[model samples]
Target: MPTSKDLCNKEACDIQSCLKKNGFIPERCRKVIEALERCCEKCSYNSKHCGSMSRLLGRKDEL
Candidate 1:
């Protein structure tokens, strides 16, 4: 079975695209944001790229 980190690798770009289309409005992309948060939390301590998702996004509560 694929892990959260694996899923994250596949869907990370969705967030980027959504942000670009919505003028970086996170509230407008709640679903995508939540999905990425789940992945980031799963990979927090294990994946270097995902370790700082909360810090990088400035929404620590979500992660």
Candidate 2:
């Protein structure tokens, strides 16, 4: 299985593409993409899942 980091690192990993395909509004998904960028910038190996996990667990309602 591809880790989130590997998924994001792929040249084809367009967040907008994924969101749009999944029926998410591009505008709303932008926030998630932005957060992912911010988190990944600080992650070791630039792991994409690290950023995603941060956003997921950071959401008060989701926790």
TM-score per candidate: 0.58, 0.34
Overlapping backbone residue pairs in candidate 1 total: 0
Candidate 2, superposed: residue stretches over 4 Å from native: 1-25, 48-63
lDDT, model 1, position 46: 51
Instruction: Give the least accurate 10-residue stretch of model 1, judged by summed lDDT.
Output: 47-56
Off by over 4 Å in 1: 1-7, 56-63
Q: Give the Cα-based TM-score of candidate 2 against the true structure.
A: 0.34
How does residue 44 of candidate 2 score in lDDT? 53
CA displacement after TM-score superposition, residue 35 of candidate 2 (Å): 0.3
lDDT tens readout by residue for model 2, 1-63: 866557445322555465668685445455556555565654553675655445432452432
lDDT of 1: 0.62
Worst 10 residues of 2 by lDDT: 54-63
Q: What are the root-mean-square deviations of the candidates from the true structure over C-alphas? A: 3.8, 8.2
* Per-residue lDDT over 1-63 for candidate 1, one digit per residue giving the tens place of the 0 to 100 score: 766445575446777788799997767777776777677666663544364345534573553
